[model samples]
Target: MAKITYIQTDGTSTIVDVKDGDSVMRGAKLNGVPGIVAECGGGASCGTCHVYVDKDNTRPLSTMHAVEDELLYCTASPRLDNSRLSCQIPVSDDVDGLVVHVPEKQI
Candidate 1:
């Protein structure tokens, strides 16, 4: 399991043990972590699961796919260099201790 931290807009933090191969969005939903809406259920369709990966994190995430790249533009929050769809991030030892910041809104 990978330990992923989700930081909310109000400065709240939630740490969850996400099973390997599960998307970060799935982890948040399973653990009842606030902020991740996941309206598309990890289908990479809706951008409700958008998150900002910690810029200082050393772990490298998977390359963004074309679909995810396009969807990021539709997120409620302003897209940043670190913006990513939580559904596109799979949990594993490679990304253990990953920290993501949740935007203020997801609608």
Candidate 2:
């Protein structure tokens, strides 16, 4: 399992262990991490699953499909450069220490 950390806008942090092949949204839902709505359930149709990933600048995120990028524009909150849909991010051993910042609002 990968240890994923979710940081809220208020600075509250939640850490959950998610098995490989599952999405970060799934981890939040399963572990009750707040601030992730996941309205589309990983479909990348709705943008409520948005999160700001804190990763090394030199390492680019993997598997960010065009649909995720398109849906990000529909988020209730303004998108940031590190913005990403949690559903689009799969949990894996490589991302064991993945840190994501949850926005203040998700609709």
Candidate 3:
């Protein structure tokens, strides 16, 4: 299981043990991590699951695809270099201790 951390806007963090092959959005929603509004589920159709990949882990995360980039650009929050749609990140054993910071808002 991978240890995933979701940091909320109010400074509360929800840490969950994500199983391999699970998406970050699925893990967050299952663990009741607030601020993660996966409107389109894990389809990558909505950017509600936007997260900032910690600098240290950015390189290890999956590379952004064209669809993911489009979704990120459509998000209501300001996009960062490390911005990523959590749905695209599959939770696997290799991603243990992954930490993602949720944005202040998501539309």
Candidate 4:
């Protein structure tokens, strides 16, 4: 299992152990971490599961893909360079300490 942290807009943080191959969206939903609606499940079609890869800790994350990049434009929140769809990020041992920041809202 890989441990990941989800930081909310208000600065609250939730740390949970995520199973390998599970998307970050699943991790947040299963752990009851707020801000990830996952409207389309882990399909990467919904921007509702939007999150920002913590600039300080992205060693465990994969490079953004074209599909994910296209979907991010649909978010209600202001997308940043670090913005990513949680559903597009899978948990793995290498990303055990991954940290993501939740936006204030999702469209």
lDDT agreement with native, every candidate: 0.94, 0.87, 0.88, 0.90
User: Residue-wise lDDT of candidate 2 within 1-107, one digit each (tens)?
Assistant: 88888999989999999999999999999898999999878888889989998856333356778998898887988988899999988877878888999998988
For candidate 1, report its TM-score. 0.97
What would the per-residue lDDT of candidate 3 be over residues 13-98, giving only the tens digit for each residue? Answer: 88999888899999999988988899998998989999988778843667789999998988888999989999999987778888
Worst 10 residues of 4 by lDDT: 56-65
Candidates ranked, most accurate by lDDT first:
1, 4, 3, 2
Best by lDDT: 1
Those runs of model 4 whose alpha carbons end farther than 4 Å from true positions after fitting are none
In candidate 2, stretches whose alpha carbon ends up further than 4 angstroms from where it belongs are: 55-60
- Model 2 scores a TM of 0.92
Q: Give the TM-score of candidate 3.
A: 0.94
User: Which candidate leads the pack in TM-score?
Assistant: 1
- Candidate 2 lDDT at 51 equals 93
Candidate 1 positional error at 3, Å: 0.3
> How would you encode candidate 4's per-residue C-alpha lDDT over 1-107 as one tens digit per residue?
89899999889999999999998899999999999999888887878999998988747577788989998988989899899999988888999999999999997
Model 4 gets an lDDT of 0.90
TM-score of each candidate?
Answer: 0.97, 0.92, 0.94, 0.95
What candidate 3 gets wrong by more than 4 Å, as runs, is none
